[model samples]
Target: MDDDDDLTLNLFTPAIKKNVGKSLENVIWGNRQQRIKARKLLKLTARAKPTKTPTLSESQSDVYTEKSEIANNKKRKIADVSLDFDNNKRRNDGSGNVSSTPTKKLKDSLHFSSLFNSNPEIPTIDVKPVECIKEEVFSSDSFESLSLDTYMLRNLRETMKFNQMTHVQEQAIPPILNGSDALVKSQTGSGKTLAYAIPIIHALQAVRPKICRGDGVFAIVILPTRELALQSYEVFRALVKPYQWIVPGCTIGGEKRKAEKARVRKGINVLLGTPGRLADHVIHTKSLHLFKLRYLIIDEADRLFEMGFEKDVKLIIDCIKEKTLKKQTVLLSATLTNGVERLAGMSLESPVRIDVSQDETTCAVTPKIDLHINTRDNSNECSAFSVPDKLKQLFVVTPCKLRLVSLVALIADKCVLAFKKSKMIVFLSTQDSVEFLHKLFSNLFKENDSVSCMNALLSDQQQDIRKSKCLVTFYKLHGNMDQKDRTLTFTKFSTCKNGILLCTDIAARGLHLNNIQWIVQYTTPGDAKEYIHRVGRTARAGAQGNSLLFLMPSETEYVKTLSNMKINMKEIMMRNVLHNLLLLFEKLPKILENDRRPPRTYEEAATTLQIYIEKVVNDEPEMQEVAKKAFQSFVRCYSTYPKHLKSIFHIKYLHLGHLAKSFGLRDAPGGFSAGKNPIQSKKKHFYKQHPCLEIHNPKEYVKKPLSSFYEFASGH
Candidate 1:
């Protein structure tokens, strides 16, 4: 039955006992019969009796114990051997038996001691922050204070009433009023331009002596952007305007060369322009002699480096070095990064740095910017059929033009802001989409919808055509235009109410518009800085604005950084009001002349109206496909339009829509849609195009030098 029971039955069997006894009987004991019986009996008695205990000597007992210990040690060794044997048995049988003893493979495991203790390297990093040089106040009356020229005083009073003295102005002015070499770190819009203007004016007024080439340009303000130069020039001109005798002229890009040459030839006290233009005049043209130039100002110092104008700035500075009078250099900037500080050190000798941290006095009225971060399981998956439902207005940014155009087609009766060249360049994914879109709009309106494309490659005439149409303008801006012209155009387009202005980052900073209702990123920016500047254009002036980013999953880091900045965006969805609105308008005729029902109010609209709008308008299969694609692009771009009756499209009497209606257009469409842009349409174009680029040959235009007495003075 079982192994143990079988063993027991075999051991105590009667048959085994009988066989043993018979064997014993057969085997007589020692020698004779009697002896054999005795032997037999003895054997039987031995088998039946217990063995006697043997007495041993003390030494024998010790030997016995020693032998017992040796036996026990041998037994233990046998047990260890048995373990080894079992391990081998397991290996042979293919059974897994993990070894208890620890064994580290040198190649696989890293030791902490070896990693940390051997060949240790201590890394060193620089942790010092840039320091600002302290400035001391000077008595305003330390030097003879003549009743400032009545005209300059009036302008100064007005400026003081509107704006307070900036940190640069507060400290540097006394030195400038006293005539000192002052290097500064005040940024744009910080009044650095006015600081030097005031001192130059004071010096000009103090002396009534005749000026000559030996005296050079009295005051030269060097700037990187034509806009900034113009701004500075205008400020300087206004300060000295009460006294028309002190004529101050500005030479910048985008102007008639002949007109600028004529103005420079007439002689002025001050000159303002970019480095290249100013340098060309100084080196080739002898019109404005720099030999007598007393004051030199470099504005927006950091911007000079950023725009790759350092070499130009340096060259201009070198040209002025040849002047007869030792010039005083004043450098101004906002953030004195290491590179800029180094540039300053190289440009100015023993200069003082004045940093005015943003304090209570600075304007803090910029619109309240709130960032939202969307948290949902649908984080990365936006349905293709959903439009940006959370967004009222939206902009989509993309690196691919065809993608952008194709996206526009699916969204229904929406205006487009497209790049001109790319409109013609065929997209790999959506070939002929642009032309198709053009045809679609044209057919809808019985002619091409007033739509425009703008880029830097188009001709001025072409741009004008687009602008004049006021419905849509196709345009381009080349590198040739002056900075002022560029800035103005950017501002005009950005604030065009319902118009779309497609542009590059050149229009990003120092330009804010209230009318830019949405921002779109067609593609994710490669870095964080570019992203910040792009979204910055909208959501300006405290108005509720939205931005959309179309990005891939691989761009999670970029999305994270944007989220960290508090930009709340959801994956695009098609079930949105904006998407539905586009479909409705696309199917509806352009005008319903007698349907005079006031547009639905935001309150009257159903809370879930945006979703219903999508369902009702996208009822058609073909239109649904387009809606799906549009929503895909919208989600990729990070925009949303809410679905609800709370807000509806209504006609208004202002901005882009109003202008469009005035120009023979009908009611404004619902949601964030483009209206006619009026830039190229305005009568201002009738005048000779404003000189947007000023290229001066220095030989023709030069400014008169200020008096030496005032230039050398120590205080105001």
Candidate 2:
């Protein structure tokens, strides 16, 4: 072997074995060429590079250091904009572990672009000059009573049935009526709306002599959700009926914007809605004015500030404050958290802080220091819990897979007491969960007609619900649905005699749906505060309601955390069988074929949303413009977009590669194919061995796969 061959001979010995008589150098060169070609091929094919074990730590670190941002699009200057309407400051408020620091230029560009893209055909919205008429103030004359006129007093007593004033009403109403800014922290469902509502109505009545416009709003009440907005609007609607001059208008997302504008043009005395939709009008349209805004109520004030509405709400407050110096600001929330004290200082002038929450203080000392109890005060008075006194809260400890079966069983059991009006609100943590649970329930109850009482009310007739005469109703509500569809779903669920609403936390706050017999926490809330709100959905206004919280062995700790709120959660003794649950799901093959079919893959849901968007824009051309305003939120609803959805959705991210990585590749593979049922292939029946019984428990309850954890309830 020559000098070059001798040195390189060992390298090619493995390679030379395959091709005998080949020179060592030649063999080494050929293998190197093949490797180069293979690398080129891989790059061309766009395959992920295989990561190797670290020869040194720095070499391994380099693999992860270069983060590709696929969101930045050079094609458009209006790219990667997190618009004012969509950007909730809380998400990017630097409170999270990751970077929420959005680009300043992107936010500005997005806001302007959306505003600029609004229909030019919409008339130059002009805010009618609101005249603040001065009269004998109610506070000065008689602050002792509600300080409302005789007619108003009668309405408050007779219509609202307010016999004795709530502590929140007593403390908050006086300062507000006297033209003072008030920061109120009251319990949920404590008539906080009335404390502000009664005073605002009274103040408006004082200005009755002034010329009023039917097309503009005088007072704007901002809430976190459309459901809450609707509830507050109802309070105003019913209160203002006595004064025919007072017109209340609701302007929230999920309702027709054009229709809302028309209502504004018709002149509304009070505008109750979410920050985003209201800001959409204030900035993008001139259809409304705050020139005479006497009362500005920020209900769920902490939520408005915390859940990323700080920018929108602050923008609103700025717009109103600029127009009217005398606007009385009222901020009401359960907790004045997330720097809300700072907000109160900024917006409210010498505001009276009303904290009527009667919960007992927990000891900060260690358990052994005080037996984990506060005994020093020696007061026997049990503090009021955040969960209402009327609410019967139950914790159903079960596996996630068993939750659906448990829900069905509970419904069957409770249907009798509901008296033909079994209204349930099943709260899930994610939109995907909401959609899945809705499909599962719909499948189980396909034969039971009129599930969606909304067919007659909704613009879409695809469900054909109007024709059905049966009672059991089912509906789904989440952020993804078209606003119009969402509104219809909310209305249908609100009005239905026996309806089931499968929803996310989106429907948790301020939704005052009557006869809500149960609030099923299909998925445990993220924390104790969320649990409070979920359970708060029922037992509202002195009505009896039940809340079922599903818990896994790991999740039982959350129940322990509810100690701060003193929530009485009774653990339910589940009397269920697996066979009964499987049996309840009758004729799945036929139902799967008949009801179009449940989403067999992640792509299916994304594709469905894409089609939904297309159909909405196609059916109504004007909606295309509105859709642009909400473009970011729309894409974010389904973050993992496949090629079909990605192309159809057309999202512009700030860093394309980072977004791609954060979400996922567009061409990800599907789940099991539609035709393949992983279960037994027996097509005729669910099971021949276990003859279907009237038994409601799960069919395979006895099949103890995770049976060890099933005993978790005993420990609790």
Could you list the CA RMSD of all candidates, in the order they appear?
Answer: 32.1, 24.0
Collision count for each candidate, in order: 63, 37
Q: Following a full C-alpha superposition, what root-mean-square deviation does model 1 have from the true structure?
A: 32.1
Worst 10 residues of 1 by lDDT: 707-716
RMSD of 2: 24.0
lDDT of 1: 0.41
State the lDDT of candidate 2 residue by residue for 596-685, as single tens digits: 445444233222222322343434544433333222222233232223223322223122211211111211112211112212434233
Name the runs in model 1 displaced over 4 angstroms: 1-150, 156-178, 186-192, 208-216, 253-259, 358-501, 509-553, 559-716
What are the per-residue Cα lDDT tens digits for candidate 1 across 1-716? 44333322322344322323442433323244433343333333223331222333445434544554455455544443123211122111122322111112222221111101111122222222222222222223311243345656656666534233544566567666666666564433335666678888877766667443234368788776554565567677777655555667777656555777667777767888877677666676667766667777887665455555666666777777766447777777644544455446544655555654322122111122121221222212211111112222232222111122223332232343222211110111111222222323333323223343534467877656543442333222223334455656554654454444444333333334445545555444333333544565554322344565543222333433444433434444322323333333323323222332322432122112222223322344554444333332222222111111012211121133322121111212222222332224443431122121121332221221111101010100
TM-score of each model, in listed order:
0.43, 0.55
